[model samples]
Target: MENRPKVGIGVIIIKGNKILLGKRKNTHGEGSWCYPGGHLEFGESWEECSRREVWEEVGIQIKNLRFGTITNDIFENEHKHYITISMISDYESGEVKLMEPDKFDKWEWFEWDKLPSPLFLPTINQLKEGFNPF
Candidate 1:
């Protein structure tokens, strides 16, 4: 079998000292709290995909999108993986709504230092590496 990298994107929507997080509603990592993002669809630019995903999943428009981090995840059991490119963005417009109700149960803003535990592993790691709690 040939190996191919799965490309995905994540948006870190920061407002003051808190960050936006979504409780996943879909099967893969369902019930896990994560950043707003999803797979990069074919032929879509990273910026476009990032903005689209943030809007679709969280119902908000994003501005000042900038490169953040890239995570390469390799699962041992399922042979599933992802190469996630993350970005930092400011909230531009729109009210919070569950656009994909089945994919996410809820949305909340949390202080970085006080984020709930057991967050999606990659997101947790990214937080540690890229964000300063204080």
Candidate 2:
């Protein structure tokens, strides 16, 4: 496989004082908690990818998009690399429901300091850098 860092987008949808997150399933970060996001598709802008991923993952529309944080996540055990760009947005509408049952087991909002354990690598790195969208 060609060694190239894939571009990923993570959207931190804000609702009140909580952020949206999901427990990953059947993927590289299986069992870890993560934001709604995925690989950036070809010819898509950062905001476009952010919007698409959030909707595709959890059936929500987001507004007030702003740049949040970036992390170079290297999953050594999985032998995968990703440059993750996190975007912060206000939850515009729609109920938070799992759109991809195969990829995520649960979706919920959590306070920043009360996040679930075994967070995805990009999330872990972002938090370590003290990146907070709140």
Best by lDDT: 2
Model 1: which ten-residue window has the lowest total lDDT? 125-134
Task: List residue ranges in candidate 1 displaced over 4 A.
Answer: 1-3, 128-134
Q: List the residue pairs that clash in candidate 2.
A: none
lDDT string for model 2 (1-134, tens) is: 68999999999999999999999999999999999999899999999999888888899889999999899999999999999999999999999888999999999999998998989999899888998888
lDDT of each residue in 5-103, candidate 1, tens digit only: 788788888877888888876556666788889899999998999889988887788788888888776654557788888788887888878888888
lDDT at residue 50 of model 2 (Cα atoms)? 90
- Candidate lDDT scores, in order, read 0.80, 0.92
Instruction: Please identify model 2 stretches exceeding 4 Å from their true place.
Output: none
Best by TM-score: 2
Q: Cα deviation in Å at residue 57, candidate 2?
A: 1.1
Error of 1 at 120 (Å): 1.4
> What TM-score quantifies how close candidate 2 is to the native fold?
0.97
lDDT, residue 71, model 2: 94
TM-score, candidate number 1? 0.87
